[model samples]
Target: MLVRLALAALSLHAVTAAPAPQGATTWYAVSTTPQGDTVSPPTHWYAVDTSSTTTPSSRTTSSSTVASSTSSSASSSSSSAPASSTAIVSSKKGVGYNDEYLTRELAISWAYNWKSRRGGELSEGVTYEPMLWGRNATGWATDAQLGLDEGASALLHLNEPDIWSQSAMNVTEGIDSWLTNMSPFYGKTNLVSAAVSNSPEAANLRWLQYFFGNCTQCEQETHAVALHWYSDSFNTSAFKTWFTDAYELLQKPIWITEFGVQRFTSSSNVTQKQEFLEDVIPWMEAQPFIERYAAFGTFPGRFVNDDGSLTALGRTYSETV
Candidate 1:
């Protein structure tokens, strides 16, 4: 049976699902964290599942109802039509873990034994969303190694591409080089989005433009761009206005990679989180260019970790998306 399964694995199967009722649309939330990790909060992803069995039918004409008088020998023939396609909507969820530990485990489990473990099968039918924090040599190496091993897909979070004090143009060049070198092994990589904010160097329009201009390589590589928006820096209207304007300027599909209301002195209360989501998500979704959306940090704390988990925020994300 195993041998037979292996033999049949490469064959592509046609998949279809019922058309969304009237104006309804379906979006999938693919989780980005590892299968079983407790510390890191789960990252919810929205991906279009291109593989399914439910097919939509076309309208058919009724044969002449009054064909009783003639020979009365009628036959019906069926025609096969092309399948309909659906769009994938995905978001990022962050689970905390020492980066090295997660990457090492992933390499061992997914890459070496992928073929036997049905990686090809999984790849064919479902869109896997993996999140990568683009920082440091070790993290980048780990991400590349894991991709080679598991045959996994990713939405790389390149928030601060240059931890060192490199210019935005130089940083983009470096990223382009790194991705180019890694491509042979990784195949077609999908960069969900990238950002460069909260840095002293990246504080001006010239820097932002340079950073985005560098992202031209990413677009050429078919990677989508994610722009980060922070509430602390800008008010709701201002934030939306800036992003909308930027999207127009960039002329590429953008995802709100990270947006949240942070309470530094006290823990994040449910009210603040709820208000933030209620105000932001709908307005952002209304835009046509924004492809996907993700909230920053699943728990209440910062990226480095702190006390208290905003369970309410987590629940709200799951419920709303």
Candidate 2:
């Protein structure tokens, strides 16, 4: 069952954005403050975007800092702790597939290369679920084949359920059966998570419910609700509202799987991105039910400029998260 984003334009050109430089870095980690208060400054640490930067020198480092006051701004509230259980972190350390570079052929190629590179098997505890678009039979087969090789789990993306009418129930059922048959070898059955169309499109929620409700297997097997909440269109309050609503309605754990602010194109500067992340992290960390939050495009090549540098938002994400 290939899950896809119904609203994302699916042209050959649109799907495969140019790959970033081989040595670019995308993700970096930072230490949390001891008191679990706000992020302390002198937060200048940065890493190359791994998706783009392939240079040998572009490995993780603890260098870099920005000067700021250390005085404690104490608050009475207790800080939240990180989520205890999550899908096993992949033993293969690096970025997974790039959404912008997704295609049926490319996805197949990636599965082959990824499986081979990771010792021709999935990491013992890690799950590998790539996003699939459309009713792509070949792609689904490829995913099952890769699962056989890697022993990884998967999550199918149902981009648009409204298009999958009752008339197509037979086809959907067949796909469901195929997925179930593949599950024993793959370690776990793949779950389905729908993409929410832009906020103005109120019908997307109905479409999501309809699709999930119709698939008995998916309803029973699905573990998490995934969403891509872009910081650009949503302010802090709006995101909080959405998170709260999703928690109340879904009952399943929520993963803000893909999220980021576009600092390169917007009038909002990098400081805004940093501030936004700084503000959001504590709030998200505090949420008891929320699972992991992965920022969009941690690779420098995906979002940064040609000079091999960090975008303001990228820097902030690295520093704060």
Candidate 3:
């Protein structure tokens, strides 16, 4: 239903965008290219993490607001409560992994890869949230349908659309693609949105605000919002600022589908990554609004050893509460 939009009706006072600062704009996050990229990876995406300012742009409000989005037809689906199930016991922690079987080791709570199918024979009760990567990801619609038919509880929308490399899509294209491919599944499952990048320029929030403004039906259907975060080193203050800005604008429960240190580089030490994890995981769990989160697993850093064992960082993330 339009729960996302409904939850978003709560408005902030007369506010405006804050001036961009230096420290926040210095970092960039290059999305890790999927192995199946038939050709060379595109150029890196350097997001300017502007100061955490929930500046009210031209109707770029919360993920859930805007009165004139969709038509009456949308209410047909919106009328129905999303399919519910006891299969997924709620937990704030999950593993982001490419290989599902390896998750059996860290089997903390949940796991998801880039695709729709729950990888093979996943641990029982380990909820597998399927992601429809993007419009560029061929057969995304069909795959999303398959996941819904298979009783996937929560279906993720576009990846990092704010980033040119990952799930690159403008607000209009994102809405059109979603309405055509993902809208039909609206009330059938928990639909996550935009999966906006941690663009330092505050592009992620803007992208979402525009999306919610333009596509009322799409915005109405989105059950939760998704955010991706990355930083060169473990800077918890930067982390908090980014997440806070998003929540203040969106006002919806969040699913941090991807996050990590050394987002696009290998310079991150295991200890630093562990410090990052130890610092963020508890903070994430403590936040009542952060429904669930999954780190960028397997690549860019070592979540599992080549022998299929948890690395120190992995163990820290897996074993921590």
Return the lDDT, model 2, position 283.
Answer: 73
Clash totals in order: 14, 28, 7
Model 3 TM-score is 0.70
Error of 2 at 190 (Å): 5.8
RMSD list, candidates in order:
21.2, 19.3, 11.6
Order the candidate numbers by TM-score, best to worst. 3, 2, 1
TM-score of each: 0.48, 0.50, 0.70
Tell how far residue 22 is off in model 2, in angstroms: 51
The sequence of per-residue lDDT tens digits that candidate 3 reaches over residues 122-238 is 555566777866666577667777766765678887766665455656666787888877787777888888687674543677778767766778777887798887655578889
Count backbone clashes in candidate 2.
28
The top-ranked prediction according to lDDT is 3
Better of 1 and 3 by TM-score: 3
Q: What lDDT tens digits, residue by residue, belong to model 2 across residues 1-321?
A: 121222122111011133422343332222212111111222332222224222221112111210011012111221221132121221111123233332121101112111112223322333455444433444455665675366544444443222221011222433364354333333455453544432321233433344344555554566555554543443778877766665555555555554555332343465666677678866765565455455544233333334434455544443442
Sorted by lDDT (best first), the order is: 3, 2, 1
Model 1 TM-score is 0.48
